[model samples]
Target: MSAKPSGSETEIVDGGSVRRDHTDRFDLRALYETSQLLSSSLELEFVLNNLLLTAMSKLLSTKGVALLFDPLGSAYRVAASKGIAALPTGTDIVLDGIDTNDPMLEDDVPERLLEHGVKLVFPVAFGHREIGLIGLGPKFTKQPFEERELEFMASLVNMSSAAVHNSLMVEELKLANRDLDGKVQQLNTLFDLSQEFNATVDRKRLVKLLTFALMGQMMVTKHVFMIRSVTGEGDNGSNMHIVTAKGVRKEDLDADTIASMCAQQDMVLFVEDGDSEACDHLREKGFRLVLPIRQKGDTGAVLCLGPKMTGQTYQPDEIEFLYALGNLAFVSLTNSYLVEEQIEKERLEEEMRLAREIQERLQPRELPVMQTIDAASLALPSRHVAGDYFDAVRLDDDRMLYAIADVTGKGVPASLLMS
Candidate 1:
């Protein structure tokens, strides 16, 4: 027969089994809510904050902190916190992987967290590596965390770690794309300048265009342009003359300073130490960079620039391109000067030939003969047209007069004066 309970006795019951069923249902609901909240955003900081808040709520803890690992520095930094005032953000700690499942069971929790009253440490792991840690104070109910609750916390972190890592990767890709776009823009600017430089030959206009292009590209306001001073018959010279200047006193760029800069074959920065007096003068004039324009192993020109208006230092690639463009402009200016010289020489030579022809025509082809007495004349010409002349005049009876004269100067002017 089945046993029946007596009125004073209570029937046996499995209270532990009933409690386990209730706890399982509660844990499932909490996990579902945590997943939904964390997966709603791709922003790392937002995800971290939400994760900490959810963990604290589920565990009934008063304090919580999230520390994310920075692989570059090989350390973990506090990324998010709640309810703990003294746990400042961005605090670094070095904690390796642990075999113990519960942080409270570990022998060595970092003192930074221990001193802040952190009682539990949970690893947020992804793909066999720990990416961060979650620390929490004691539960509000003063109840010890069960095995099921710790396991559920680990599952929650695992799900969120993947999302965090993916967000970081996306951010890196965006930065790389921006850098590439900047490079392409620089290349296009250089190509346009090259086309303009090819079509330009006027010295003044060329310098103006070059200056404008450099100022616009580099974002600089102060500049000085120096080109070699060509005199006499040849295109080469060692003297450098400043062609244009702005944002600095022109007199400050003295002769000796320019000469010293023109002697250098490479770009130089005017710093505080180990520089010559000329460089010091440049610094005083607010010039930060000096770039040489070399022709045939000698500096034919130089470009001086002040600090960038954008407050950024010039990169190596930018300096290299400026050097190349400066040299190109120098060559074009030199060619224009040579062409002008040749044109002037040709024009002078043509005028000299015309003057000689007019002088020859003005003289009598043959001297008139006088019957009473014999008269003779001879003419000799020099390589250059000198305004020397000889003429004969006769009066009817038996008298002849011979005259000679020389005019000052040479070529056309002298010939016209003589005439």
Candidate 2:
């Protein structure tokens, strides 16, 4: 028998002889380069494809390669492959544990490998987690794999596993960022719409604007505003009047019934799909939401909405938006009422001023310098412009005409007619 080679030498055992030669450093360099390439990229698809291509070109010395990932419960998705005749994209393969000794290999194997002259199957895993498997066809030189080649293939599989793990983490981070961005955009839109609503004072126009703003911002199908009159007789009685409504039939709503129910229940908000008994009747009536419009501790009105245009149920965010919109409507209504009242007060004051002018002219100026038994007369008007008149005129031959008259009211009409 031939003597065994030293530690630093390569030994070949053929027949009954042993030959020792220097080890080839090229294979070691190839392995290091492959590891560097695999570690550099964290993108899942890029890393996976590079790993397969590098292994086939440098480590395994194969003409073709294939990478498969068994998402376990999901499909057996193909990541990358080379050297096969038009390798299927997103192909599923059944793997079996008996088919290969690779630790990352699955229990069900693809049957095509048997017919296609596959030389090796490598399982790639991160710790105990089986990320995927690799398959390689025979080398172009048609040479059998030596022990050294098998060892290098094993190292490549380890590098591939780490790359796959990093890629998956990156993908998960990207998805999370996208979700967060969507939420932030929604919040920004809500804030802007709220600001616009707060600046208006016309009740009818405000209600219409609010409904349209909410629908556009939140992408809802329809919104309705049902404003109940504040002044009405009886506490428990049906006094709810539909002052304004949109996106629904005014005739279809029973305003008195809704008002009475709201008054009895003492509920300010009624979400039709939420867990509340107050919303039961509203839900049956095809309304998806009912938001109360409150002003200074009194429930003055209700704003309702149907389902969203997306046909999805309302989320907590959507409910909050509706509440804000309802509050804005109440503020606008109150402001409009105050403006109307002030205008009416100013109008009445103007009329009183005009009446005073007419009354002052109606009285005789300087009392005609009369000398009928030394008579004199004076008239004084009240703050409300009363129509009290006094007159004295000297007639021919020392005869005098004197008269005093009072009209009922104290305005332009009474003053003009008094003349």
Candidate 3:
């Protein structure tokens, strides 16, 4: 079937000319179907591809392309292409003076488009802004476009622009929702870790929980944990001591290396290509991130780990979460140490009280009476048991000896000696 020129009205002909109402009916029906198809989906790619295909088939063009405007940036890229093999999708091209006012012919189109073999350019526009462009090659008839054809094409593009803009907005909203979900999950993980840590007093158990939380949340592969002191012993003037480690070679991060890390007082990333020797050294030791576990503004511990198991770099937000967990670990451990010290002090005080009682019992309650001599004894007990002893002895009828001795040291040992 072909449609040819018939005065001011178009006609449909099979073997002979048809009336103008039939052709009008056909075009009206086609436009209705095209509107239905374009409004069917919110998927940007599907809508653009279908729109371009419909336009090319209607116009009898061999090639067509759709370029979408990037709402977040100042660039336009090819979104859909047909019957053109050399053009690359996502390639950006700039077209100046191509306003959203109306559809443009090849002469009115930008000169830059000639290189892409585009003959017709339609601005898919809505609300005074162009959201996309539809480019079409020459029609198969190789004839100039009629006024009615341009008007129809303009209507098609104008109607589809709103749908395209809505689809792009929907995609942007989905991406924002996904990003918000990730942040929420990260916060939940940190909160859970903090609760578990606050309940924990044992250093080993705390480290184990930290490792599990870190690996579960951040997908860590290799890590080591260090504290300022261990069992209050073997500090040997060093500030940091390694408590536990995994996947680390010996001589890589010793007490000296940890001291250097603590000196920074902030999180550090070891870059393999860094200009600093210290960072390069850390990188060579398989450490990608080092964090200080601070308590009361002092670095009480350190945490070091390699790259994520998935080989992704640690993001700033993830590192901040690690910092928070690290500080929580330090505070928990410090509280445990304080509680242990308090208990030890209380035990020592109780022992001193018992020792004082025993020493009092060992001393004479009253001095013996002497018929010919007057004698007095004074005993003073130290805050800790001092173990002082005194005795009045009668040797024969006329001889009396007074003896007194103070023992060395204090507490239970001195109290036992006095007894």
Task: Please report, in order, the local distance difference test score of every candidate based on alpha carbons.
Answer: 0.72, 0.64, 0.75
Could you give the candidate ranking by TM-score, starting with the highest?
3, 1, 2
lDDT for residue 57 in candidate 1, whole number 0-100: 78
Candidates ranked by lDDT: 3, 1, 2
What TM-score goes with each of the models?
Answer: 0.56, 0.49, 0.65
Clashing pairs in 2: 64-83, 94-108, 94-109, 95-107, 95-108, 95-109, 96-107, 96-108, 96-109
Report how far residue 244 has shifted in candidate 2, in Å.
Answer: 4.0
Stretches of candidate 3 off by over 4 Å are 1-38, 48-159, 230-237, 249-251, 265-274, 347-383, 386-400, 406-419
CA shift at 190, candidate 3, in angstroms? 3.6
- True-structure lDDT of candidate 1: 0.72
The TM-score measured for candidate 2 stands at 0.49
Q: Higher TM-score: candidate 1 or 3?
A: 3
The lDDT, on a scale of 0 to 1, for candidate 2 is 0.64
* C-alpha lDDT (0 to 100) for residue 414 of candidate 1: 72
Native-referenced Cα lDDT, model 3: 0.75
